[model samples]
Target chain A: MTTSIRLPKELKVRVSEAAGHAGISSHHFILQAIEEKTLKEELNTNFYEEAEKRYTQIIETGECVSWEEMRCYLESLQSVPNPIKPIARKLEFNVKN
Target chain B: MTTSIRLPKELKVRVSEAAGHAGISSHHFILQAIEEKTLKEELNTNFYEEAEKRYTQIIETGECVSWEEMRCYLESLQSVPNPIKPIARKLEFNVKN
Candidate 1:
């Protein structure tokens, strides 16, 4: 698709300076820059999506490693060459019923 | 000034996905992304320009600290509380007469 974007006066000057530095035309520089930002934003979106999925799963399943178990695993890193892996257990919430 | 850019089929789709994630219209997202990239590129150009200027000055002035002095200062970092600072001396090129 083809579309027009309005560039401010100062932004136009900056683009020209940047484009000259990179030995490319202002239009080419803008295109490349937009492509880069699009890819970066896509990666960020994917990261947050994955994180949200994991968080929802944790909430529903209540399957997570306890802080004590995690601490033990971390502390064993130096003393114990082969530390036992921490296992995820169902979380228990104390509800006042 | 307004200019039209033709986006490839795949890139257009990617842009839409990214724009959706950002909760913004594709045009707005493109504009924002382009501005971010332009600013980043301008900074990079400025950095290189500064480095180039410094390098040109170093060559023209021939004022630079010797590597040996630099190494001595680095080595003294642990032992000496106030290590003598390395002074810049006019670099002498051992050119054959």
Candidate 2:
């Protein structure tokens, strides 16, 4: 799939390397990646139709929110009519640490 | 669900705008978006555990291959031992055009 191209250049190189090491083409490698991503997203999501409707939007926007913040907001919705919603921001992973 | 925070800045503003329009917080808007995305991905993918294993890799790499390209590659795999796999490439969207 054109999946590999959607990936960062370094990742494309890694996928190719993985494919080459396994004696397969980069095409197969990307297919597996897309399938894997799809499955993972399904497991985390609660709504199917909603996802389908928003797929194009999500892709075009390339926007994402973390599960933790969404969960907290949802939990608050049940109790507070005017709940304090978390602001949308970037992941503070600080991966290097 | 620190999900909304994972979204891009523009998306964050849009979510907040939508939330304000609907008399809700941006948090709820983002939560819905994440759920929708998750469901959409699941429908497209065939495997589950493989997806879980690759989520991190996918996010970090940010690569994407189109479904059409991937499907062709897979079909070739069935017929050719050394299928001339499609090379991973960027989408020729040319959205403006």
TM-score of each: 0.62, 0.22
Residue A13 displacement in candidate 1 (angstroms): 3.7
- How does chain B score by TM in each prediction? 0.60, 0.37
Give lDDT tens digits, candidate 2, residues B1-97: 0101233355445445555654655444433443343444444343654786666555666555668888988998988898766654444554784
**Which of the CAPRI classes, incorrect, acceptable, medium or high, describes model 2?**
incorrect
Which parts of model 2 have CA positions greater than 4 angstroms off?
A1-97, B1-8, B47-97
* Candidate 1 residue-wise lDDT, B13-66, digit = tens: 988888888889888887787688777877887788899997887889888888
Evaluated on chain B only, candidate 2 has a TM-score of: 0.37
lDDT of 1 by residue, A1-97 (tens): 6767777778778778878887998888878877987899878988998999978988898898878889989999989999999987797866798
Model 2 chain B worst lDDT run, 10 consecutive residues: B1-10
The candidate that wins on lDDT is 1
lDDT of each: 0.83, 0.53
- Per-residue error at B66 for model 2, in Å? 30
Colliding residue pairs in candidate 1? none
